[model samples]
Each structure stands twice: as structure tokens, then as C-alpha cells.
Target: MRLLVTGGSGYLGAAILKRAPATCELAATYLAHSIAQGNAAAFRVDVRDADAVNHLFDEFRPAVVMHAAAQMTGDQMLAVNGDGSRNIARAATRVGARLIHLSSDVIFDGEHAPYDESAPPNPISPYGESKARAERVVLDELPRAVIVRTSLIYGFDPLDPRTRQTLNGEMPRLFTDEYRCPIFVDDLADALLELAQHEFVGVLNLAGAQRLSRYEFGIKMANAFHAAPRFTGALSASYPGRRPRDCTLDISLAQKTLRTRLRGVDEVLQDLPGF
Candidate 1:
């Protein structure tokens, strides 16, 4: 399979590149950060530019496109995350490539926990709103696209941003009430590739099997990094703006469908060689 992975240098994409099957021919695209793909070729393509994306499609002619490039926060959220997604979807359709877009659980408000694919999107944060728009854009452009809604991704090797932040003692207080199903990067990567080779489309929740609060997730990180639990104090998120409380996903469909198992934080942490 000729495949293209956007955001090649990013956390999740890097993991995918590392774990992708040997049978598949992979090319990864990056914006800024330089990636060292052992076998896969690395290309520079900005998803925000429609012409650039089209050029990439013409050049690479990828059979499967993993739309993982995203603008996580700030004012550029709509432009890079929303419009950028539209560009990718259109380009992917032009090339007749199966698009697998990565989406977040924050699309739904925390009032509802264990969200299924049928849940309506009611995003509170700017990032979440942008992702919700991205999803719509992808589906509208490519009806056969697979939208994988996942949660906080962690890798025990201290590469993932969230894992790095916690291990380095960057977070002052971890929210005790905020709940999410944190999946290991490797597990998520494997599941994504398995989904890519299939004809399955529409939204699918691909997250960790176990759901826990942000505080508990930090405790797992602490266990892996050998950090003090006291460093990650319990602090309920409080703000004037609406904050998602429990963006936990229901991965029952993925569990029943895919052969690749989505392992939880606890299981992953216990198996971490560095821990």
C-alpha cells in the first residue's frame, strides 16, 4: 500500500511511522520539525495550503492518507485545524485516497461521559470547536473517510507532549475531575494502520480500554517516570469559559471490530521497560 502520513514529526504520527507494517510503503509529511524515518520517506507539506496539498497528492499518489496534521490551540485553530483539514480532504478525494482523519474527544461537552459515535458535538473550547469543524469538512469532502476520535495519547519513552510535561514536572495541578481514556501511542498507531487497510468509514471511537481522571493518568505517568505523586496535586478545573469535564469515549465498536487491542495506561505503564 502506498500511504501518506501528515504531521510525520508529531507525537502520534511519529509513533505510526515507527510501528507501521513493513509491507506498506509509507511517506510522512512534516511542517517544521525534521523527522528521521528509517525506511519511510519524509516530505515537507503544509496542509493549510490547498495547492501544496494538491501537488503532494499528484506527486505521492498515496492510496491511503492519514490526516494527522493539526493546530492544537491559539488563534490559528480555525485556519490550520479546520480549513487545513478541508484542504487535505479535498486533495485526498482528488487522488482517490482513503482518508483517516484523527479527531479528539473534546468535541463533546464533559456533561456526557463514555460518548458513542452517535453523540452530538457540542464543543466548548476553541480547539474542540475547530476539530468538530474538521470532522464535518472531512465527511463532506470524502464520505468514505474514517474519523477516529481518540483521547490524551501517552508514550512511556518520554516523547509524547503530555507525558513529557508530567514527567518534567511542568503541570502544577492535574485536574482530578477531568476524565479521559488515555491510550498508549504505540497501541493507537497500530489500531490506526489496521483501520486504514480496511473499508470501514464514518466515526469510530479508538481510545484506551480504561477510563480515568487526569489526576489518575498523572499518577500512572508518575509511576512510569518514578516521580512523586505529591507533585501532581488534585485541582478541579475552574474557569469562566465552558470546560469539558469528561470526554471519555466508548470504544466498544473498535474493540469488537479491530484485531489490534487498545491498551490502557495502567497496563502500558506496568509493561514500560523504563519504569
Candidate 2:
């Protein structure tokens, strides 16, 4: 299999690249930083630039494309996450490649809990709106694409950004009411790779088994890291803007669909040396 991974240097993308099959030929694209770990041929191409994305796709001509590139914040969120996904979908279709697009649980408004694959998107935040728009554009471009909606991705190898922030006292407080099913990066990566080798199409809810509040998750991570000055708990309403209260994904379909076991944060954090 010839696989192309966008955002190859990112946390999730790099995990996928590192865990890909040995027989598979790999290529990756990045906007700024090049992939430092994977053995794939790297190309620096921003996904927002349709021509650049098309040229890279035409050259690589991958059998499968994992569109993980996205912008979470700033004025370029729509351009990078929404329109950029469109570019990837178009390029994948042109190359006759199967596209697996990474989506977020934030797409939902959070009024409902335990969302399934059939749930419709009603984004509440800018990031959620961008990801939701990305999903729509990707599906419009390639109807056969797999839209894998996931939750907060956490890991301990290099430590996730959220955990890092908590450990270093970067964040003043963690929301006690905001709940999410934080998936282990390895589990998610493995699941994505397994999906890549299959013909599955349409949306799938892939997330951790346990649903936890941000405060609960943060506390566990901080405990594992043996950090001092714990993060104070606060309600979502305490913050300035509108935030999703609960975006827990129902991964029953994924549980039955793939062999990869999606472990919860508690199970994953047990891997720490003295946790």
C-alpha cells in the first residue's frame, strides 16, 4: 500500500507513520516542519494551497490518503481545516485513493451526550465549526471517504500538549463539567491503520471507552507526571466564550468494526513508570 499522511510531523500523524506496516510505501506532506521520525519521503506543502496539494498528490499518487492536517485556532482555521480538507479530498479522488479524514467530537453542540456515528453536527465553537465544515466539504468531494470522528487524543511518550500544560502550570484551571472521551494516541493510530487496509466508508465514532471530565482527566495526568501545584477545577460557564459541555463519542461501531482495542485514559496512564 502506498500511503500519504498529511501533517506528518504532528502528534497523531507521526504516531500513524511510525506504526504503519513495514511493507507499505509511505510519503508525507507538511507546511513547515518536516517529519523527523518516519522513513517516508517528505514534502513541504500547505493543504490550503490547492495547486500545491494537487501537485503533491499527483506526484505521490498514493493508494490511500490520511488527511490529518488541520488548524485548530487563529484566522486560518477555516482555510486550513475546512477548505484544506476539500483540497485533500479532491486530490485523493483524482488519484483514485481512499481518503480517511480525521474529524473531532467537538462538531456536536454537546447538548446531547454519547454521540453515535449517526449524530448530526451542530458545532458550538470556531474549532468545532471548522471541523464540521471540513467534514461537509470532504464528503461533498468524495462520498466514499471515511469520516472518523474522535475525541481528545492523549499520550505519555512525549506527553500530550494538554498534559504538558497542566504539568507545567500553564493552565490556571481545568473544566470540571466539560466531558470528553480522551483516546490513547497509539490506539487511535492503530485503529486508523487498520481502517486504512479496509474498504469501510462513511462516518464512524472512534474514541476511548471511558468518558471523563477535563478536570478528572487532568488530575490523573498530573498525578502520573508527579507534578506540583494541581490545576484548580472550574465550570465551563466560568470561561469567556461558548464551549462544549459534553462531547463523548459512542464507539460501539468501532468496537465491533476493527480489531484495534481503543483503551481509555485510565488504562493508558497505567503505563507510566510509577503511576
Candidate 3:
């Protein structure tokens, strides 16, 4: 199997590359970061450029395209996350490659609890809106696309960007009201790779087993890193503008569908290696 992973240098993408199947031919894409660790060949790609995406597809002829690249904020969110996804979806359809697009729980309004695959997207933030648009575009362009809607990704060892910042006191304030099913980066990567080899299509909630607030997650990180000074007792309301609350995903379908065990935060962090 030939697999191409976009955002290969990203936290989740890098994790996926590390645990990817050896039998499969692997390739990775990056925008700003370097492909330092993986055996996969590196390709600099801007998913917004249809021609660039199509050219990569033609050259690589990837059997599976894992579209993990996306802008976090600003107008780039619309250009890269929204439209870039469409470009990738179109290119994947043209090349007959199975597309697996990464999505987020923030696509839905926090008013709803434990959202399912069928729940309608009512995004509150610019980033969330972009993901919602991306999902629609991917599904429209490639009906067979697998859109994996996940929550906040966390891990130690090399450490995730957000987690590392929190450890260094960079992200001092974690909201108490913003709830999510924080999945281990490895678990999510495994689920994505497993889905890549399957015939499953459409939306699937791939997240951790337990639902908890960001504050709760932060506390766990603090305990793990022994960094209690960074903790600022804040709520979601303390932040400027809108923030999604209680966007925990209902993963019953995923639990029944996937072979990989989607371990919860407590389970994952308890046995964490190398502190």
C-alpha cells in the first residue's frame, strides 16, 4: 500500500509516521517543519494549490491520502483548511486514492453533548468554521472520503506542542469549562492508519474513551511534568471571543468499528514512558 500523509511534521502527523506500517510505501508533506525523524520521503506541499496537489498525486500515485494539514487560525484557516481540503479531495478523486480527512469536534456548537456522525455542524470560531467547510468540501468532492472528527490530541516523550508549552508555562491558562475527549496521539494515529486500510467512509468520531474538561486535562499534564506553577484557574468564559464547550464526541460507533483501543486520558498518562 502506498500512503501519503500531509502535515507530516505536525504533532499528530509525526506520530503517525513513527507508527506507520513498514510494508506500506510512505511519503510525507510539510509546510514549515522538516521531516526529521520518519523514513518517509519529504514533499513541501501547499494544499491550497490544486495543481501542486494534483502534481504530487500524479507523481506519487498514493493509494491512500491522509489529509492532516490545516491552518490553526487567521484568514489562512479559510484558504488552507477550508479550500485546501477541497483541492486535496479533488486530487484524491482524480487519482482514485482513498482520502482520510482529519476533522475536529469544534465543528459542532457546544450546546450539544456527545455529538455523533449525523450531528449538524454549527461552528462558533473561525477555526471551527474552516473545519466544517473542509468536511463539506471533502465529502462533496469525494463521497467515499473518511472524515475522522477528533478532539484535543495529547502525548509525552517528544511531547505535543500544546502540552510542551503548558509544561514550559507558555500556555498558562487552560479553561475549566471546555470539555473534550483527549486522545493519545498514538491511538489517533493508529486509528487513522487502521481506517486507511479499511473500506469505511463518511464521518467517524475517533477520540479518547473518557470525557473531561481542559482544566482536568491540564491538571494531568501538570502532574506528569511536575509543573504546578503554570496552572491558572480559569474558565472558558475568561477567554476572549467564543470558545466551544462540551464538544465531547460520542465514540460508540468508533469503539465498535475500530480494532485499536481508544484509551482514555487516565489510562494513557498513567503508563506514559520517559515522564
**Candidate 2 lowest-lDDT run of ten:** 222-231
Write candidate 3's Cα lDDT for 77-148 as tens digits. 999998999999999999899999999999988998879989999999999999999999999999999999
Let me know the TM-score candidate 2 reaches against the reference structure: 0.97
Q: List the residue pairs that clash in candidate 1.
A: none
Report, for every candidate in turn, its global Cα lDDT versus the true structure: 0.87, 0.91, 0.90
Give the range of the ten consecutive residues with the poorest summed lDDT in model 3.
224-233
Q: What TM-score do all the candidates reach, one by one?
A: 0.96, 0.97, 0.97
| Cα displacement (Å) at residue 57, model 3 | 0.2
* Candidate 1 lDDT tens digits, 82-198: 999999999989988999999999999889787999999999889999999999999999999999999998875437887677767787678888899998889999999999888
Give me the runs in candidate 2 sitting further than 4 Å from their true place: 271-274
Residue 206 in candidate 3 has what lDDT?
Answer: 97
- Model 1: residue 24 alpha-carbon error in angstroms: 1.5
Residues 1-275 of candidate 2: C-alpha lDDT, one tens digit per residue: 99999999888888888889898899987777779765899999989999999999889999999999998889999999999999999999998999999999999999998799998899999999999999999999999999999999988776778778888888889999999999999899999999999878999988999999999988878777767645799999999999989999999999999999999887877754666
